[model samples]
Target: MGGFTLDDILATRKPRDSWWTVFMVDPLACRLALLVANHTSITPNALTRLSMLIGFASAAAFTEGMLVAGAVLFYLSFTVDCMDGKIARLKGTGTPFGLWLDYVGDRVRVVCCAFGWGFGEYTRTGDTDVVLAAVGVVVLDLFRYINGPQLKRVKDATRALLETRLEGQYVLAESVLRSRPRSELEQAAAEFEQTAEDTGATVVDLQKAFHARFPWYDRFRVFLVRHRVRTHVVSGIEFHAAVFVVAPLFGAAALVPVAAVAGTLLLTFEMFLVYRVWLASRQVPRTAAEREKILV
Candidate 1:
């Protein structure tokens, strides 16, 4: 599309971590978005706002029991969502406010969509369980917002400690949040690094003590939050694809429940894993020799 090569389109991607995004949805959508960008006056933030509107329309369709229509709208929103990031990177117009707006917009969309599903299901079957499931979906999503920063704090601290040990200096840098801005993230990281430094604690020494105090916490947290398991468990392209594309083939009845069940199962598993990790973390420390052997 336009004169944009695949490599050129890919270069517009902000973060290339999510497997679904990298391998499936984003490339084609981003290519199209880039072409549109070249030919039109549409801006990245404009696409973001458009996606939000599409998301709300998707919810309205779901509320009317038009499952296929809702799904289609959701996909369009998601594609536009992808486009906004590509456009942002392409134009270098990204701002903290835009990122914040995107984050809020996503959460609001999900909640509204869930509510619409529940209300539609209620109209269809009068089953209150589905409504509760909708609530569960909202809770599950909100938990991520609440817990995410703390989890990131732990991860950043661990990373800084490890990198400091390995390299003898600490670098303050931002980790990308899908909907949050890099500039804000860098600001937070800078503050975190300064606090860590001011404590007069060597990053490595503190990390070793922290690890010794909470043995399995780091391992499980890393595995659950940052790896393949996380990608599959947390919805992105997969959830939307399943809801809009696959579920309609079965029936509209499966739409909300499928999303709810998937999210609940993953959230439940994470909760259980956290508890297990916490229990393991409370264990007494191993000796220095044991620690050395384990580290090696």
Candidate 2:
């Protein structure tokens, strides 16, 4: 018998998705993932490998000046790429190796496609700017991805430190008040405290968390998510879709400008995201190790 229904596959998707995946990629990926998960013995790692091969083929198509083929192939590759994650989450078969492969595969695909497009157009037009645009694409893509993991690491560390402090606050509140906490934040921290004390386990989520500081931010996020798009409007997914899928329709002359505009938009959103993260960090007091690391 099959593992999951089509509805089950759809439910395996992220709580929120980027605009490109939500609108362009996921609908088809979900349907395909449904079929593969139910009917085939194919694994998530295998799907990832297949997606990488398709992506490489798309890059090759671009290099050969097959714009229509390249665009279709790239879109197809992305759809398959989306499917692997869904299958992994749905089947509980995900591994650290699969995650690493997916991340590295995405970077390789972008790099290959950028170089292929630039070289193909340059061969026909003799425009050196295309080469520069290609290089810029590689650098910008690397910049975003490199920062993302590091930022996530920092956020994780901050949360750990914040949790410890909240635990302290919870203990003190219990000793002193023995009643309702002062604020909503204290109310949540107190509850978490009681649960952990009863179970002797770790509690990760501090309700009324970092977002609670800026209530409007939560509302903004909900509003965007309600429309099926994440707050990051021009993230890596949108950047690739713009450069590879959308730009090709306008011919070689449009590629550089399209890539340039895409890069700018990506940077703008990314920097804004960094600023928001910094502000969120300020809400949580730093630990001694964090302070020392910053100094170094």
- Best by the TM-score measure: 2
Please give, for residues 91-157, the per-residue lDDT of candidate 2 as tens digits. 8888889999999999999999999999988898889999999999999999999888877876665
Number of clashing residue pairs in every model? 0, 0
TM-score of each: 0.66, 0.81
Q: Which ten residues in a row have the lowest lDDT in candidate 1?
A: 172-181
Best of the candidates, lDDT: 2
User: What are the Cα lDDT values of the candidates?
Assistant: 0.63, 0.79
Clash pairs for candidate 2: none
Q: Report how far residue 182 has shifted in candidate 1, in Å.
A: 29
Model 2 accuracy (lDDT, Cα): 0.79
Model 1 ranges with Cα > 4 A deviation: 1-4, 160-249, 268-296
> What TM-score would candidate 1 get against the native?
0.66
